[model samples]
Target: MGTWIKETDKAIYLMDGAYYLQKIDKTAHTGQVEGETFFRTGQLKTWLNSKEPPGFFLVSVGTGVSEPQPLPPPPAPPLSQGITITKSPSQVKIYQPYQVAGTASTSLVGKTVELYIDNSSSPAAKTTINDNQQWLVQSVFIAVPKPQVRNLKVVAGDASDVATLTLTPYIEDHPGGTKLNLGGSVGSGGSNRASDVRKVQERLIALGYTFANKNYETFVQTIRLFQSIISGRTAVRGVDGRIDVNGRTQRFLEAANAPQWMLMPSRGVGFYNLEVIDQPWDKHDYGIDWMSNVIKAAGIHYELAYRKNREGIAPIAVNDVSLPQGGDTIDHAGHETGNAGDLALPRLDGDFGGITWSDRRYDRPATKAVLEALRAQPWVNKSTLYFNDPVLINQRLCSRAAGHDNHIHFEVMVPPTP
Candidate 1:
């Protein structure tokens, strides 16, 4: 992974994104810019049921689609299997395992050669190659190696005063099988979420939602017409920015205390059993990045909700927020309820309006940082920033939103599914 190609008179005579070489001219006339050379690198194949095999290329001058003479037929993908050995008068280095293998190649020193050998790494035979770096080897290893068969080859260069050598790797498939498939990942959490209530509110302001700035999904269609873009399409700010709720506005408190009292689905108040590609359980994508960023901003620490999504972004759940109805009772229970997700209380800095989650104490720094972090995500739809006191929520430091008290519920806007 650390290899880099340098701009030189020579070029990548071979490709696998790894083969590197400089050009050599035995005679002055061959040094012309039109001159060319050849080299070979190994092949790569996929072994995982879920992945694809990799391929390499044969690079040569005059092959650039000029419809001129095609240098030759390109090598088959199978040729990438074996080891590529570069031999100097005293050393032979193998390419691809990307690291040291055994003792054979490194122990030898003496004898200059830049080519040869075939399919097998079994060194056809053995002889006197001194690693003492003071001698030369006359022995040849490997025999009758096929170009397409994965194997190792000895490439020795022609020397007089030339510093460049060709790099040709012979790939040979093992008799049983080559057996290749190896790699690992970490997730980025967001301080905000797709369903953030506060984000939904600020975006309304960004879209001219209203002075009240509440009940997002209910107003999404109306605000959609105000979100004008360069192309002249109406746009909503998406759930990006959030207002401090606990201050002058009891909006956050209203929503947090309200939604629970609303009419729940037949499934119940929190029946969110759904999946989206952007969800942690889905394949990795930009969605996960947004999620993690939102949580981080919220001052909450989380164990990845889904592993598959850890590779990319995960989608968020789709639900609505509303005011509570009469005769509604609240239940604070952790049952892995699909609708009610948990957060690291210490991470979220605790509850607002004397409301506490999981016995964790809330901190002001996390609260402010969380607000700032969510402001950074583009998908947030609204926010609900709660404060311990109402005056703190209405303070000048926070924007001039109308109703905020309990907490700031943020939102991230996801594109409509078509």
Candidate 2:
């Protein structure tokens, strides 16, 4: 039960499980006396003491009594080592300028910290450790031409760490715009920057365009062709083949570079006549591959039923599925994920018609056959089909909703990988 007592000059003592300080005046033995009383065994007494400038001493009270033992010194503080990276996002835009920050050990202070991308030997960027053992490489730019996952390795002295970041398309803020600049000259008869042309070509390739070379001539031809396609023009006479950093071409390129969901080709045995609406505000008609497969199967089923009896079967008019990148669209919900599609109801008289939810001519038999085909798809189940047809709802072929009286909306169960 002895306690420690602090005295002048960093000294401490323990007595009777308690601590008491001794005044070493020699003139006054008023405090606990500093004389030792040996036990009958004749062993020297010991006590706890701090290893500072002034050491501690033990004072014995009487013979046959043991001195209180001092507690062991506390363990030393752990050494600060190992570099750790922190405070960075796990994802960034392709052309964004980001900062990599971390702390280094004191031993590594003033040493160089290098950042490597994708395990490249040469450092992409570097910075010196400050006196506080902190390092930061600011305004680090990664020129990613496409969407991908990349690794960043930081090393300082013997300490190192790594981080992963996903790079998306570099879409600039158009103040309600969604475009990115090409950043260098791109076109024919111009000083073609290879890097800039490569970016353009990558985007073109993503959007189903062909560019064989990275030279100015090839770039100019590609640009002209692209302009004509987007403009819906047959002649390329007035379409300029040049694109600067920021322009309509850049905006289109940005949109083209976005992630794509594969659209089912407009071809099949008995279902090749389906028309995909190509309107400006509704130009994009893409969805997950599985959804496309579902649509294709349903169309074939509809056509087969007509061929079996030689009865006239109207072609199914397909509406929007999702945008190029699978996001929100005007006048619709739940299509943001690219798993939903809308098909206009067929006409009873075997004629192509528009979207109609409640019209009496809404061909109930053909619509039912289409639903059966969709539900038969491996990826479709009871809850995947949406329609407002009372008969279909009663039969549990589809769930009823308020606005689906004229059309059928089908959403796949799972979103396929991009």
- Number of the top-ranking candidate, with TM-score as the measure: 2
lDDT of 1 by residue, 18-70 (tens): 34322222223344565554333221111112143223334344445321121
Model 1 CA deviation exceeding 4 Å by range: 1-362, 381-403, 413-418
Q: Give, for candidate 2, the lowest lDDT window spanning 10 residues.
A: 36-45
Tens digits of per-residue lDDT for model 2, 284-319: 466544456556655554454332344677655567
> Highest lDDT, which number?
2
Please identify model 2 stretches exceeding 4 Å from their true place: 1-260, 270-281, 305-309, 355-357, 415-418
lDDT assessment of candidate 1: 0.27
Which lDDT values do the candidates have, in the order given? Answer: 0.27, 0.55
What is residue 103's positional error in candidate 1, in angstroms? 39
Candidate 2: C-alpha RMSD after superposition: 21.2
* TM-score of each prediction: 0.19, 0.37
